[model samples]
Every structure is written in C-alpha cells, then in structure tokens.
Target: MKALAWLALAGLSCMAAADGQTQFAQKANATDVERYEYATNLDIARVIHTENIPDDICEVVPIHIFYEDSHGERHTLEYSVMGGHF
Candidate 1:
C-alpha cells in the first residue's frame, strides 16, 4: 500500500541521517593520528601513546593508528573506545 511505502521511505531516510551523524562524530572525536616504522619487538617500546579516559562517563575515544609493513605496504588499525568496558 502507499502507506507502507511511505513508512519504508521514512525509515530509510532516518537511517541515512543516522549514518551521516555517526560519520561526522567519528571524524570529530578522532583525537590523534600517527605512523611508525614496523618494530621488531612486541615490547612496550612499540607503544605509541597511552591515554587515560574518564571511567565514569559513557563516552568514546577514537584513535587512528597507521603503520607500514616491511614490504612497503601501508596498513591501518582503527581503534575506538565506547564506554571502556574492555
């Protein structure tokens, strides 16, 4: 029916808006980005940074980590914190 079509269209529009908002938030919340040469050891020296987020709030911290392999190929590890239950 026409009513069902309208409902579907409305739902789709809402989803699209939500997606756009989510993308904007991600871009805005990203705090830092960095890259480093591939390290040989898995020790603490490989750590780029350590951030402390407030444990009491329900928030997310977005981090962008990029690196290159020995083969000269670049890679990305997209990491985020959502309420930090991890």
Candidate 2:
C-alpha cells in the first residue's frame, strides 16, 4: 500500500512538470508572435527558413520569413507559429 501511494505521487509530479513545460512553451510562442508582428510592416511574406520541432511536446514552429515594404526594403523576421489540432 505504501509503495503504491509513492508510485502514484511520483506519477502525478511527472505530469505536473510536463504541464508546466507545455504552458511555458505556449507563452513563449505567443510573445514571439506578437513581437514579430509588431516590429514588421510587410505587404507579402514568404518562408525563408524552417525547423521541425518535436510535435509530441509542443506545437510551436520556428520559421524565418522575408517580406518587402512599400519602400521596396526587404525584411527578414523570425516568428514562432502556434498551430495544431484545436
């Protein structure tokens, strides 16, 4: 009975840690998206870079995008896009 209780507690702790990490990642992704969006003025953008992150843990994706403003100046920005099953 005591061993079973200990095992249950351990499992719960692990779950809590996983949840915390997921939340942290989500907040970080949101902040990055907002920051990038605010700092750029682009008429059209295209993905210049991509990296495959682990899908099991989080849904945030890293991408480098390029765009041109009205003045014909090109800008490259890094953004974290949160996408997955809702």
Best by lDDT: 2
TM-score of each: 0.26, 0.32
Q: Model 2, residue 2: what's the lDDT?
A: 45
Worst 10 residues of 1 by lDDT: 40-49
Model 1, span 1-86: residue lDDT tens? 44323322433343323454444434533344333223322111122222333466577654333333355443333345455444
Whole-model Cα lDDT of every candidate shown, in order: 0.37, 0.40
Give per-candidate clash totals. Answer: 0, 0
- 1-86 in candidate 2: lDDT tens per residue? 44323322433343423454444433434334323444344343322222333345446665433333466554444555555434
Model 2 / residue 4 / CA error / Å: 49
Which regions of candidate 2 are displaced past 4 Å?
1-57, 83-86
Whole-model alpha-carbon lDDT for candidate 1:
0.37
